[model samples]
Target chain A: MKKGTMTLTALLACVTLAGSALAFGLGDAIGGAAKVWEKKDAVVKAGKAIRKGTQDLTPSEEHFIGRSVAATILARYKRLNDPKRTDYVNRVGLYLTRFSDRPETFGGYHFLLLDAPNEVNAFAAPGGFIFVTSGLLAKVKSEEELAAVLAHEIAHVTLRHGLEAIKSSNLTSAFTIIGTEAVKEYSGSQLASLTEAFSGSIDDIVNKMVMSGYSQSQEFDADAEAMAIAFRAGYDPAGLTGFLTSLRDAAKGAPDTGFFKTHPPAGERLTKATSVAKQKKLTGAAAPARDKRFGGYKL
Target chain B: MNKSFWTVCGALLATAAVAWAASTVTVSVKQTSVRSDRQFFAPTVATAKYQDKLAVSGQKGDWYEVTVNGKKGYVHASAVGGGAGKKEGSSIFDDDSKEPGKEDVALAGKGFNPQVEKEYKSKNPKLDFAAVDAMEKITVSDAALATFASQGNLSPKGGN
Candidate 1:
């Protein structure tokens, strides 16, 4: 195998092993150890190709992807039926999308407000699809902070992180099992599990495949991208660091829960994000007094 | 390998994705005037014609052609849930619901729920509730708020 493929294979192995250790018994790891590294190159190659294709997708193509991901997510948590929150999220998402590198003139980014007020999470997918919970929105102090979150999700789509991971893997079997709909259904943690099983070892490649995340470096890149997007949209870049710091602080005492457990530790992410913000001169940016008009949402 | 192959596969995948994505109902709104002097309107309203359940339509107007027990007549937008499609970029009704109605003077002294009232008081928490409640208790006439109100669906939430 080529040197790059070998290295990726080892990384994939570690990620899969880590997830396996978390979910299954240590005994199973010994049994499935040999099979992990096989076909590693093909999977990585496929992931790279998919990422490239997804990135190259046109505005309409991206929107189509967004709609699928958004629908699947909305269907899973059917309890939050508030249209006011839904409409508000969509309006804000669309507004942010207007400032993205690629804006959809035909069909702008559509948002679905998940009524899962307790789910402290939000996401953006290809094709301008986005979502946020009332729970997450409730914690946001300003519109700029909210915009910062949206911009980060937007960066994921622009970077084609999910598609790239899928492309690089020999996903014929997995695709058949989960399908694209499954991608929407699987939470970040669940994706992390899958990555461990597929990746021979664990590292960046496994991180991308299972958890649908970029590495620490990749995440920092995304943060920088988010800052630029927010700044360009006339929002303060400090919003990115503010929200990231809040997430880091919130994760400190909480149980090992949700996506944070799968990717890099929140503290490191927060530090890197702050450094990136400082490097970009975001610290000097003024906080604009703005209110998000989600008045009817009762927390 | 060629353009045709790529186009064909792309279209197929896109169509499949679109089909899977479009589960939610699409509602549209139209504006109409009401005859009542205490004319009221919600921020938005969505109504389905009595028989045509599949073809649901939304209207953000001062008066909506609402069907109550199959009897069609104009109802105050505020009486029903108000402002369905109008809140998005498009406003079908030119009339602003913010304009006061006759005899429906704003109430003084905020007591409806200090917390909710405080947050949403600017939207005129002082409703002519005597007149509005006389017509109907604080009901969500707008689609978004109605959506919020209907979360538990069985309970009534007081305050903004």
Candidate 2:
């Protein structure tokens, strides 16, 4: 009777150990497999979804955003607060706007001449607003050069640069709203100051928010667009290079301030523009003289 | 156990962490007082034109270059104290960070006045803001020197 009892105990112990080993091993293996599979599935699904969404943005959507942003910019620059010279600006701006790829009516581009004559500058806001400062005009030699500058700004708009800038940034909703509101609410001086100080040491933050400029690729693209527009409108492509070179030379003497610091060096810009003109096979076309309609305003 | 856990944790944080943003540099006016007392060496009658050159670049004294008419001349360093390179408040704009709408241009008027509107009108009081709006229509050639070689306005012989 004692021998039978001992044998029974040993058999039970062996059975318990084997059962536990099988259960733990199988359970862990299955769990680990499931976790990895889930991660892989998620990644594939996410990538496909992203591809689908990008495909959804049609060219019309691009144009729609482009027009709204441009109109808001033009309205802001109008400084409707100053009514005395509005017609003169409006007429010239309207003429230029008429020449753009998108007519001014599609969110017509307007020009604003700031009263500061000593400080020279101009810009093209996305959509169709072009701003030229009296200060900047004082520096220009003629209508064609002026037109070349305007055409460059116009290309930035037609190419949807501003909207593209916003879309590419990884901004939080709050900052984005602030930027949008700032664009609409800030007056020119405010905008100017905001932009002026943007180039300070905190470069890392500014690049993320405003995207200070187009990619080297975008700059090239805009140059092509500007040249095409100018060439078609009877303006010479070489004028763009000449204007860029002259600005480069003048920059040496001008107070080391503002736009020149932000823009590409004059030499690099001229080289690229000239190369493009050559590639397009455009030759010896003459642009207008500085003294014609534009000569009277020089200091 | 310890090494694997730390490695996994690091990978998770790295994947989840937010990316960095772009930044700008702040260039301030070095002082509140313009260096007005400074003097220029005028060999003869102190001509106002040619002043940007006379202000020796590294001189410790404050030298102001003033433009009268089309000519640029040097000013009494003391009178210039209100304006030249004085340290104003620090402001920032982006240099080269890759985000969107990042091109913020800070326009500093003749002085550091924050309001470009008032500054605009004050500078050109003769023309109302609207008439001056036509100024944007002016070309670089219209304002600066032009290469008239392309345009018929200058005979090939007459242009510089």
For candidate 1, report its TM-score: 0.43
C-alpha lDDT of residue A139 in model 1: 69
Structural similarity of chain A in candidate 1, as TM-score: 0.61
Question: Chain A TM-score per candidate?
Answer: 0.61, 0.56
Report the lDDT tens digits of candidate 1 across residue range A98-184: 345433211334555556655566655444455566677876766667768788777665555544443433333233323323123
TM-score of each: 0.43, 0.41
- Error (Å) of candidate 1 at residue A3 is 63
Q: Best-fitting candidate, measured by lDDT?
A: 1
Instruction: DockQ each candidate and list the results.
Output: 0.01, 0.02
Cand. 2 TM to true fold: 0.41
Q: Residue A55 CA error for candidate 1 (Å)? A: 4.5
Model 2 lDDT per residue over A15-37, tens place = 45433332221222223668557
User: Pick by TM-score: which candidate is best?
Assistant: 1
